[model samples]
Target: MSKNKKLDIDLLVDGLTCIDNYSNDGFVNIPTDKSALHPARYFKELFMSELIKDGVSDEDIVAELDLSDQNFEEFLNEKAMVTSLLAQRLCVVTDMPAAFWLRAQSRFDDFHTRVE
Candidate 1:
């Protein structure tokens, strides 16, 4: 693989893998610095990938997310933490199941709260 292609895969893998960072498949076993991967981060990557694949623009996402520039920046930079409204909007736009997004958000909240 080309260097740039390998780097892209590494970034994708970083988003998908849990903090544990090992997969039985071995191909995805690269480690990250996180101790517990946040679901919001995972959701952001998943949603963004789909959106990019479909050629959705960043401006569109910020509007769909009902976020001002600062807020949107904070949300993405702050682990993609999602609310119910964001979940619905994301689902509607991406044709992804709302339940799946909500579940992921819930799981993330639950784990973080537990740790706290």
Candidate 2:
């Protein structure tokens, strides 16, 4: 079974007026929040550094992760959440822990939910 982890948002963006303030390389450094990383940007940075920059093709990731073409594309666009199974599969493919992905997804969700 997956771990029943406790989730919390300990630090918030200190003075973020716009999303433009955050760069895409992940981990927005908030003045008040200190150096806490934003989960969505963190994932994007991880994917780029670990996969895209390493010449891991999108199709290769789809096949290796056992994702359908559509699902893979959607994942790229952040149109879908990473299912628990997909998180585990990602751990195999990317060496990132499934728990880490789950936590990132939770944080990402919270951020977007607040945005909406």
Candidate 3:
């Protein structure tokens, strides 16, 4: 597999393992160094790729999501984390369930919390 794909898989596995660890105990070990694989960061890449492939405009997304340009930019730049409301808005645009986004954000946040 490609390096980026491998890293993605590794990070996913680590997140799952962390979930298992959490099930066993309420505590998790938090590291100091920040991770490069934040969900928003990954999402930005996939989001842009899909948008380009589908010939969707950023303006279209903003209008569909009922968001301002600055807000959308923040999300695209990974400066804002996905919340339940944002996930719901995304569901309308991506045709994915809100639960999917929620779970992804949850895993990303959990992974980051454990690492930072």
Candidate 4:
């Protein structure tokens, strides 16, 4: 394998290892109490924790996801909505399905709309 390809595989393995270490169950369990929680923040904590555990940089992940730094920061801060395009882009780095992201966003929106 080429050097970059090998590095990418190694990084992926490291990320998976990090996930295995942190997760009690195989799946990500969304909290039952959705009060005062945005899916972006919730999911970002999960995904970013794994990446950070592997020593991956936010700048690198943002570039890989083709997101502007401001936009990514805003998304994390819940100032920006998770659109279909962003959800799809997120799958590339997060190893999660685009549908999972959209579903989380939908649930979050539903909860907040009801609360309001």
Q: Which candidate number would show the highest lDDT if scored against the true structure? A: 4
Highest TM-score: which candidate? 4
For candidate 4, which ten residues in a row score worst on lDDT? Answer: 1-10
Rate residue 10 of model 2 by lDDT: 34
Structural RMSD, model 4? 9.1
Model 3: per-residue Cα lDDT over 1-116, one tens digit each: 01112112233333332322222222222222333245455455645456657777768778887889998888777677788898888767655556656766676677667768
State the C-alpha lDDT per candidate. Answer: 0.54, 0.56, 0.56, 0.60
Runs in model 1 with CA error above 4 Å? Answer: 1-39
Could you tell me which 10 consecutive residues in candidate 3 have the lowest summed lDDT?
Answer: 1-10
Assess candidate 4 and give its lDDT: 0.60
| Candidate 1 residue pairs that clash | none
1-116: candidate 1 lDDT, tens digit per residue = 00111111244433544434423321222243423345346446755666666777778877776778887777677645667787776566555445545655565566567769
Per-residue error (Å), model 3, residue 106:
1.1
TM-score of 2: 0.58
lDDT of 4 by residue, 64-98 (tens): 77889998888889988888998888777775666
TM-score of each: 0.56, 0.58, 0.62, 0.68
TM-score for candidate 4, please give it.
0.68
Clashes of each: 0, 0, 0, 0
Error of 3 at 114 (Å): 1.1
